[model samples]
Target: MPHILLVEDDAALAALIVDYLRAKGYQLSHLSRGDEVLPWLRQQRADLLLLDLMLPGLDGFSVCRLVRGISNLPVLMLTARNQHLDQIDGLESGADDYVVKPVEPRVLLARIQALLRRAQPAPLAELTRGQLHLQRSCRRATLGGQPLELTHSEFELLWLLAEHAGQAVSRDTMLQYLRGIEFDGLDRSADVVVSRLRRKLGDHPKSPEKIKTVWCQGYMLLPEVSA
Candidate 1:
């Protein structure tokens, strides 16, 4: 079962969310203040964090930023404000996803599940194919023995592709896997990230051998090329 840490100040809303999520088979830990998050996490392990923007002490953005500095734990921001800027700020601060308040419990649960699925540990300690090596413990990726400088999102994207090497991973699956959000068909965020990751992997946009485009289907990492 995935352990989720919820940092929410609203008592009523928090209770509702906890009840719903617990019923869905997740182990949950709740904290009412943002400042208490890091300290609590240091003492206990949490697979994911559901953070609210408004807090008594530190704000959600600050907490998310601080957590990103120490860990790559996925953060899904819960905000009452529906403003686009708020969502953008949250993502910029290292939040993996954001749920605008008046959100459906089912939607929240689905997001949580997607995030956990992408972050689930593999049977092996590290995964390697040819010159590419990924260290799961440290979330590090190296190509041909050279370290690849990748952001947390980029690393997750690459890891997913590497895991399914030689298979086409659909864009919808990629979006849910990396962002903990559903693809709306119009969202190009996943493509942008893939483009950046391809550049870092030394794959050309016009002729991407490492990460291949499957036309309208999705992207694939060919085992032959990676090996």
Candidate 2:
């Protein structure tokens, strides 16, 4: 069963969602204030988070940003506001998905299931390809037994690429996986970040043997080069 931590200020709506989701076999824990979420998360783990936009102390956006810094757990934003800007803001703030208010219970459930599916990866404590190794627990990565100094974002991007070694993961998918948000069609930040990672990995863009860019697609770790 997938466990969900839901942060919503509305009592009635939270109860309805909890009951509905429980019936569908999902285990859920509820927090009525945004400020309470991080503390609760410290004591517990959840497969996903159902976050509402309007909250007492910290708003949903702030909560999402903070959570993204510490965890890769999927987040789905729930909001009564129907503005496109709100949706964009939520996504950029690290929400995996956003749903407007008055959503059908069935629709919400389906979305949740989809998010969970996307978030699921092979359960591996550590991932390795060739001379590269990544420790998921510590978020530390090394190449040829030498630590590759990487920022949090770089580590995540490399980890995802390493996890799906030899597969050309799309740019949009990369952004979503590493950033916990959707790609704005025009955003080339993923490319830029990949370039930086490549430099650190000593994979020249011209004749890369470690991480390779699949023309117009995304990136992949060279499976044959795995030492």
Candidate 3:
């Protein structure tokens, strides 16, 4: 059963949501104040979060941002305001999706299911391709038996490629994965980051087998022979 942390101030609404979700076989813990959310989250293992925009003590945006800094847990923002700016703000604040209040219980449940499915971790325990070895739980990667010093972005990029070894990942998809902000102007930036990562990984741009660039598509990480 998927566990969820629900942060909403409205007691009546929260109760209704909790009851509806419990009927769907989901386990949930509730918090009425945003200030309590982070502390509760630290002590609990939740599969997804249901966050309300308005709350006492830190607002939902701050809570969402803080949570994203530590974990990649999926968040669904529920708000009474139905403005485009509100939705944009929620997404920018690290919410996986946004839903306005007065929403159907069934609709919210469907969105929750979708987010849970997407947030599921890859099945592979250890990923190796060429000189790279990635331990998922430890979030550590080594190249040629030496630890590779990588930034957070670099590590995530390598992990995504290594996880899907030999399969081409489109540039658009990679950009979406790396930075939540997606704009056409940022395409060059993504390419630059990938180039720097390739150099750091000691991959040859001329005949790169580790991260192979597919013309007009994206890149692929060729699998290495395990010893």
Candidate 4:
């Protein structure tokens, strides 16, 4: 069973969520104040987080940002702030997904399921290919045994590519996995991430042999790349 932590000031809503999710076989716990979340997380373990914007202490955005810095815990901001900018801010703060209030219970359940699925990778604790090493639990990666300083998104992209090593991972697939949206053909986020990954991986900037572009397909991480 996946453990879920919820930070919400609304008593009624918190009770509702806890009851509903618990009935669905999830281990649900609620913290009424944002200030208590981080300390609680350090002592306890949870598979995912459900955050609310209106809280007693720190706001949801701040909580999400701080948590992201320390862990790759999937954060889903479930807030009443339905404004367009609020959603953008939540995502930029490192939330895995954002959902507005007045949402159906079934929809909420689906979102939780999706996040848990993404967070739980293969049974392997570490994935290694060629000279690259990735520790899924800690979100750490090393190239030739040297640490590879990576941003959250960059690491995520690398993990996805490494999982599908030797096969082309299309921009649409990457967009959907990373941003929860399909590529618009005009979006260059995937390409930008690739460029950063190549630089960090020391791929030839001019000829790029490690992560190669498959004309019209997408990017492929060669199973064997130089250290």
lDDT of 4 by residue, 45-100 (tens): 99999999878889998999889988999999986645888888899999999778
* lDDT tens digits, residue span 88-196, model 1: 9999999999888987998898898888888877576677877888887799998888999999989888888888988899989999998788889899998999999
For candidate 4, what is the TM-score?
A: 0.54
Error of 1 at 121 (Å): 3.6
Candidate 1, residue 141: lDDT: 90
Better of 3 and 4 by lDDT: 4
Best by lDDT: 4
**Candidates ranked, most accurate by lDDT first:** 4, 1, 2, 3
| Deviation from native of the Cα of residue 140 in model 4, angstroms | 31
**What range of 10 consecutive residues in model 3 has the weakest lDDT sum?**
181-190
List where candidate 3 sits over 4 angstroms from the true fold: 123-227
Candidate 3: global Cα-lDDT?
0.84
lDDT of 2 at 86: 79
| Model 2 pairs whose backbones collide | 130-226, 130-227
- Relative to the true structure, candidate 2 has a C-alpha RMSD (angstroms) of 15.1
Model 1, position 83, has a per-residue lDDT of: 81
Where model 2 places Cα greater than 4 Å from the true spot, the runs are: 123-227
As a TM-score, model 1 comes out at: 0.55
Model 1 lDDT on a 0 to 1 scale: 0.89
What's every prediction's RMSD, in angstroms?
Answer: 14.6, 15.1, 14.7, 14.8
Backbone clashes for every candidate come to 0, 2, 0, 0
